[model samples]
Target chain A: MSATTAVPTTAGRRPMRGLGALTASEARLFLRDVGSVVFAVLFPALLVVGVGYALPGMRDPIEGMGAPWDGHLAIQLYIPIALSLAVATVALSTLPTQIVTARELGVLRRISTTPMRPQGVLIAQVVVNLGVLVLASLLALVAAALAFGLPAPQSPAVAALAFLVGAAATAGVGLLIAALVRKASAAGGIGMMVYFPMLFFAGMWTPGPLMPDTVAAIAQFTPLGALSQALTAAWFTGEFPALQLVVMVAYIVVLYPLAAKLFRWQ
Target chain B: MTTVVQVENLRKSYGAKVAVADVSFAVERGEIFGILGRNGAGKTTSVETLAGLRRADGGSVRVLGVDPRKDPQAIRTVVGVQLQEARLPARITVIEALHLFASFYPDPADPEELLGMLGLTEHRGKQFAKLSGGLKQRLSIALALVGNPQVAILDELTTGLDPQARREVWDLVERVRDSGVTIILVTHFMDEAERLCDRLVVIDEGRVVAAGSPAELIRGGNDERTFRMRLPDGAADQFDLIGSLADVHTVIAVEDEVEVTGSTHVLPAVILALAESGIVPDEIRTMTRTLEDVFVDVTGHAPEEELAA
Candidate 1:
């Protein structure tokens, strides 16, 4: 028998050399999933067109607001709501379910036995899900703007910041859910359980201004609610919503590390 | 021979159940070593610990001379593992899975060559969920060898395969070993171990009951052979004479046949004694103990019995 005399030397590649390949493969699998595509990519845009443009008088200016705010259409507020829904669909439903399923299938365990760390797969999932969420959000925005003549974000920079922070906070919560649930089906059930309530607070069922005073006050503290408010403020008023940004930042601070600590490779 | 894997006094427990207790074995470089046991006999757990998938409760494990616990990633790079129940994504095609796993290593085997070697070229585009059980097993084996690893740990490699497919997989294993990859095969199939393993350790109830080469273990047990032959209808009186022979250990008459069991010399002596008595045996058969018998003898129970228990 021939014995190996020396260990093979690794070519000085970056530690994360495989991340792009991992993410690309995960992206391919993610696109093939019809349920995930329908909910995360198509559903949000459909909601915007069906709810935003189909409703009469939604395109007209809102009453009782002064100056530039007074003439903005109520349908415009739904754009941010649509974007938040995109984030929620991927982060709450798709991301956690995929992670938990991978764990259950021993996909992560198989990857752990390779030269690459199994965490690389998790990171790849995050990157792919986030990319899908962004693309879905962009599609929603474009579809809404073309169908309903929705205006562009007044503060593009602040809107970008809001989207980044919201995506981080939402995906962090998804990772936490993946960490807590041992079964893939349980992750899906728990994810949808968290999803509907967050969507309700983000004004999916009723516009924020039309909700009762108490409900509106409570909605501002929710992660999706804060994200919706920040995005709306950036899109219409050309200003950053400090309080909403802080709430999202706080969610990231608490959820990210907790998920990391509790995560199980097996 | 250089030791590729050394596991000493390995112990593991899940809650109150001791899955593996006091297991020890050493695998030499370029040899196909085996851990043989029935289901739930801790063979999988022992190999998982060697692959660095599970932390040992009490033991020292060195794979290619590196402590797995201290450097799991380093061990992972050199030791490929085909876990008993692991799988790829349901929608991933066979070629996709191969390419993806290939990217995980710095020096991976050519995916096309690997696919050809495992006879998976035709199924390259088939989704994982659509493959048959035997095909899936072959794919799993191919994935384990894609990294050109120094050591490969395969757990229950042919559990669900039919006889023909099982033989095919065994041939593939032999080819892999011929290429100089040290293999630690975990199996319960006696024939598989007997045919392939250079050395093996038989585990029972979370302990190593016997360890040696198949030939050595079989020889270590009773070397006596049993012989049975048909005598004339009136030869029953000769049973006592055969029993009284110097080399024969025991002699008994069943119906019209006489059964004699003793050392190697007993067979010839019994034949000569029967001839001297004017008895010509029409039928004679000899039974020799195999490794399976040795396993039963040493473990105090058959593998099936241990499994049922």
Candidate 2:
């Protein structure tokens, strides 16, 4: 046997040193995935540009409500829907799938053996997904403004708050789904199953203004629907939708802890 | 040598099925200790408990003088583990995986040097999924050692590798052990245990059957040796005389060959008796009991048979 080498003692080193390095590495990996980039970062903007600019009548004002709601174009209503789509794409599809896949692959188990806990990897993943969602939503908003002359938000601060809360609620739902699913493929399948329906109720296929009263009333109860209403109200009327805010807050309060409780590190 | 890992009467169960029961062992520092068993034999459960990944249902486990159940984090800093069937992200490059794992430690080995030592320098740019089975195994070992941990628990370190690759990995493990990192290797291959392990415990059906060095275990169970040679022209008639010798246990003649099995002293005794019978034989070979023989003697079945069962 060869002589043993001298091992340096690690006396004064800190335990939580390289979480930023972990986050940076995870972000690089997230960008390397072409499918995630296309769906989470570019698809929402494409939806806005394709529907708002390519179709002529989509930019025309609807002929329903009296003065307050009159002269509102379908494209303007879609801007909030586009933002909600970005959040759902990232939170429901991208973030959960990534986390579930990491768990299935034993990546989380491998990290658990280290001095740093595996929760750091999960937090890094969430941070990267949230960053992507923000960029994607901004890109869609910018594209809408340039393509069809979409107006800026009436209250930028309230819109920003609504977006933040909406993102948190939707991401919590994603974590819940991730906690429930055991495999990456199942996470993807279940995410899409939940994503498209939530988007439908959020007025992706039919504008919220055009939905029947009964359907719109039911949509208000869904988390994404509440998010869309709050974002649209903030952008159009400059008023905070208190009920919508409460709905989103309720989703976050219930789902986040439930997901955490159900989460399996191995 | 000081004891680094101590497990006493450890017990665990999954629902109604017991995975491990009454398992106890201690590993000395700077030794390549082995836990040898078939699949589902609780070798992994025992090792995982030592690594603080699982909570034992009964008994006590102290890794590096710290109770794993009391403080898993304390062991985490000093122990590194490479779990069975665990993998890195498919899209992560080799260097990126190393760096990511390296960042988890307070004083990790240099990623570039570690990769070079593992013969992965040329494949640093390859994604994890793109690497071959041997390369993947090497990368896993590299990651396990990157933390500069005092103790490493490697589960099935060379399961799927080809013979040459397995040898290379064994060499790397020896070097790692030489660097004073105590290793607890979990494997079912008896040849691996015989070659690499200084001391080992045989776990069968969630219990330790025997524990000792390879030579000691073989001697403890069955010390019989066998010698075979081509039967000379007149030697077949005197087989009974050789079988009646003091050290000879059995003698049989089949076609052109005569086989003798007995104690270690039987070889020379059989040879002298055959010569006295005026027979000069060619093509003589001796077969000694190996760890595999010891394993079969203790477990009542071969490792492969257990795996198939």
Candidate 3:
């Protein structure tokens, strides 16, 4: 038969099967993408281990939270730190770069012509990123538990909630940045610029509350700082930090719509 | 028949440069419609708008009878695309790329079968970054086709390939067209367009200056024959005598060279006249008009100058 004839390749399939297919495809691609895999898993895990190992008596501080906590109490603090970096990498660097290259390669344009939704594209990205972070976070937790005696999470539900919230906030911001950047090359630069500052001010390096008065106060208002505070509070105290939660949620609320408006699928 | 793609007065600008302006076209179902233009002729911008990748600064577009901008989700499920200049991750094998893209569509082609058809079966395990340029381009096409799209948009279809590889790509494109899918081929190559397209539109300065079948265009471009003749010493005066014959419209001479512009059918008579004059030119050549020539004539500049225009 001639090539033009609609072969039975994908015919007879049920409609609306694209989303499932898209999700699977996106997940697999994310898994194989070395940069993302490294960013989501190894990078965060290394940072957690490196930072945890560097600070003596760090585990004492967490177990001192009045309860026995878990094995390596200090590792609990590092859990949120590792998770935050994973979220930022997936949302900011990995996701944005994917879209930018997709645009450059005409993948976005091709998707645009398909029955696929731009929102679906974004959904796939978030799903892949979130899934990767969850997997990596789990591994990091296990590794930390084994090596440094890191505390097992007290509240798994709260950790999950914090992860979702943190991921949502970062993914939204990353999508906005991706939409705004002109080309693929700019994605890395923009991600680094946004990432380091966010990591520093968000208390991943030092608690915003502990910084000198002016810096701490300003850091509190930054999205990362708010998100990190909220994530830490959720994982550690089991009490949601309302203000920080509001700021994190507010980042998504503003950025998601703006990103949708600015996103170029072609 | 319903229109599969429609574009109206589409406009797009980046900074001060207008990428596409007042561009419009429509593709009926199951035709290999070509968009021919020089580089930077707004072909990519126009296609991007229709593909729903870039929002138009103005005008409207409908692919598969839906507004791409308003209902991008609805559009994505039905359309299949392979973007220009896209590269898959280096670590992802060919099989991996196919599986990933196939997951995006509800019904996707079998990855193994796709690899086999695209001559990539042996390289399925190879990373995308490790493939040759031609192989990468083939992989790109395979990725586009895996979703089993109704309409396929290919930009620079045979670019960056050796002549043999280009011909192979042409065969593949023909096969795609034979499958009864409408194609919007964006290319700067005249020979490619002439060989593959049923009908085409030409863009100059962000607007379509010509549109028709390649044959119709070649025929319509002012019927005139150009002959180049190189002669020995005393052939000029004899060539002038031949030029005075009927249907010998215009003849110019620069030294021993003779250029004849007239009916191609009358060339033999001119040659016979020359024979009678005992004037035998050493070399004789005829100019057969082509799309390339028409492009030059219409734009009043060589096609090369407009490569990035």
- C-alpha lDDT of residue A190 in model 3: 94
- Residue B138 lDDT in candidate 2: 90
lDDT value, residue B62 of candidate 1: 85
- Model 3's CAPRI class is acceptable
The DockQ value obtained for model 2 is 0.50
The model with the greatest DockQ is 2
The parts of candidate 2 lying over 4 Å away from their true place are: A1-15, A61-64, B305-309
Q: What tens digits encode model 1's per-residue C-alpha lDDT throughout B168-274?
A: 99999999999899999999888889999999999988999999999898778666778889876666577688888888898887776677898878888988988
Q: Against the true structure, what is each candidate's TM-score? A: 0.93, 0.95, 0.77
Query: Of all true interface contacts, what fraction is found in model 1?
Result: 0.51
lDDT (Cα atoms) of all candidates against the true structure:
0.86, 0.86, 0.74
Candidate 2 lDDT, B29-84, residue by residue in tens: 99999999888889999999998899999999988777788877777877889888
Lowest lDDT block of 10, candidate 1 chain A: A1-10
Can you write out model 2's per-residue Cα lDDT over A1-266, one digit (the tens) per residue?
A: 11122222346446566788899988998988988899899999999988887878888887766644578777878999999999999999999999999999999998888877888989899889879988998899888888777777788888888889988998889999999999999999999999998998889977756667787777777888888888888888777788888889999999999999999987
Q: For candidate 3, what is the DockQ?
A: 0.28
